[model samples]
Target: MTQPNIVIPPAEQQTSVEAGDLLNSSTAGVIVERTAQVRNGFHAEGRKFARMMAEFVNVKQVGVASVFVYEETFGIKDKLHWLIHLSSLEAYEAMVHMGTSDQEYRGNVSSEQVSQDKGGGGWDKIFVDGSMQETVLMPQFWGMYGTKVDGEREKQTSVYQQQGPLTGLPGAREQVPLPVEQLVHSGNCGLLLHRTAQLEYDFRSEGRTFAREAAESINENLPGEATVFVYEEAFGAADRIHWLIHMKSLTTYYKVLALHVKDERIRDLYFQERIAPERGGGTWARMFVPGSMVDVALTPHHWGMYAT
Candidate 1:
C-alpha cells in the first residue's frame, strides 16, 4: 500500500567485512552469534518453548555483532544467536507456578517434567537468564505490545518487525506494525544491519536522546533501507542495547558506514568509543560495540510476519 523510506548510508563508515554468497538469512543470523550448544530446534520451536518456560518474560529479536559472548554467559549467546525472536529475563519469582512439590515452595512442574518439557522435552530449548529486577532495559523506547485481543496471548509479548508480521497470533502479543517496508513478502527474512553495545551508568537518557536525534539527523537521504529497531538485553547481561537496521548486503552495510565516515559524522566516531572507562563515552562509545552485523536465522520457518 505504501512505499517504505530507504536509507543508504555514506561511504566511509562501514566496517568492510566481506560476506560470501549466502542465499538467505538462514545462512547468516541477525544479531548475536552462537556456539554449537544453542542451535538445534532453537528458532523453529521458539514460540512453543515459551509456552512451557516458567520464568519467561518478554520477547525481542536481535541483530548484531560477534560481541565475544563470554564463556560464563555462553547460554545467552546461544539463545541470542539462533532464537527466531529474542527472549529476555522475567525473574523466577515473578512467574506463577502450578506447583510440583512443596511444603511452601514446590514451584510449577516437577524437576523431571521441567527437564522433559524443556531441553529434554520434544520442544525447543528456552533459555532464562539473569533476574528481571536487576535487568536494565531502556524505558524510553520500550512499550507494551498492543492488546485489543487480536487472538494473541497476554502472558507474553511478541515484538516483531522487518520479518513480516506475526505477533498477534494465539499465545503471542499483537504484531508491532512499524512500516510496510520492514518485511520482505516472500523470499527470505529481510536483510538487516545489527549493532550492539553496553551502556554506561545512568546513560539510558543519553541513549534514547541520541537515538531520537539520529532518527531525524542520522541519514535523511536513506529511508526504509535504514529503518532501524532498537532493543536492550532482558537477561544475562544488563543494558546491552541492540540496533537492527534493514540493509541486505555486506556491501550495503559498508556503504552505510562508509557514508558516515567519509562525511566524518558523529555516528562513525561513536563506533570507536566504548562504555565507561573503556573509552570516552561517545554515542557508540558508551555502548562501545563495533562492526555491522547481519541476520542469520532460517527465513520462512521463523516469520513474525510472512506471506505464502
Candidate 2:
C-alpha cells in the first residue's frame, strides 16, 4: 500500500480548548465521532479494543483518537464512542487510507489472537451488529466557523499556550507560559455533552446567531469551569447543528445546569426566542424543527491516545 505524505503541524502550532481538539486541522477543525452499541457483558473487552485502536492510530500520526463511553445519566447506557481529531479532511482521508490499506493496522485487527477471549473472533465480536453511527462536525464560534489561515491558526494556538490556566481569561491577567506538550493533552475534561438540533429552512442564520450568543453567555458565566462549542454538521443530517460542552468534572455538569436555569442572561435569550417579535420577543418557535433535539453525555473510557 502506498502511504500518503502527511504534514503534521508541530504541537505548538495547534490551538484547542476542548477534549476533541487533539490537533489543528485545515478543515475548520474537524471532529469525527463514531458511536456503537456494545453487546451485553462485553464492556471490558470493548474498552480493550478502544485502547488498541487508539494506540495504533495515534502512532500513525495522522490524528488522535480517544474512546468515550456514554454515562448512564444520558444517551444509551451501553455504547462506546470514539472521537478522532484530525488536522484536516485530507488528514482524515489519509488516516482511513492507511488504516485499511496498511498491513500494520490490518494485521492486528485480522489476527485471531487480537482478542484475549478464549473464543476469540477478533475485536468485531464486542459490538452489536449494525449499531455504529459516525458523524462529522466542524467546530464553530463567533459569526465564523473554523476557517483560518495558517498564520492565524498558529497565532491563536500561541495565545492559548500563553494563557497559563483555563481560569485566566485572555488578556485579563499576565500570561503564563504553558508548555505545548502539557497543554496538548491536559486531560482536565472528563465529560462531554453532545447535543444536536435541526433548524428550520431560512432560520439557519438565526439558529447560528442564537448558538453563538448562547455559547458566549456560558463562557462569560462559567469561565474555565466549563466550555461550550457550536458546530455545524459537515456530514450526516442537513440543517443539523451540534453543541459540545466540555466539563471539568461531573460536578461541573450540574453546575452548568443550574447556571442555565438561574442566569438571567440565559433566560432572557430563551425568552426572546420563544416569544414572538410582535410580542416584543423572538421567534424562536419558528427557528427550529420541533422534536429534533437530542442530547447525550459522554465520559472518558480510556486515555489511550492522550497517554501516548
- Pick by TM-score: which candidate is best? 2
Residue 50 of model 2, lDDT score: 62
Q: What does candidate 1's lDDT look like per residue over 69-162, in tens digits?
A: 1111112333432222222222222223313323233422222332444446432223333311222222113232221222433333334322
lDDT of each: 0.33, 0.56
State the displacement of the C-alpha of residue 194, model 1, in Å, after optimal TM-score superposition.
3.3
- The residue pairs that clash in candidate 2, if any, are 25-87, 272-282, 273-284
Worst 10 residues of 2 by lDDT: 167-176
Q: Write the per-residue lDDT of candidate 2 for residues 139-246, one digit (tens) a residue.
A: 553333333222343355433456554321121011112222222121345556778889876566567767656765766666555666667787677768887765
lDDT of 2 at 28: 30
TM per candidate comes to 0.37, 0.70
Stretches of model 2 off by over 4 angstroms after superposition:
1-21, 24-28, 62-73, 113-118, 141-187, 273-281, 303-308
C-alpha root-mean-square deviation, each candidate: 15.0, 11.2
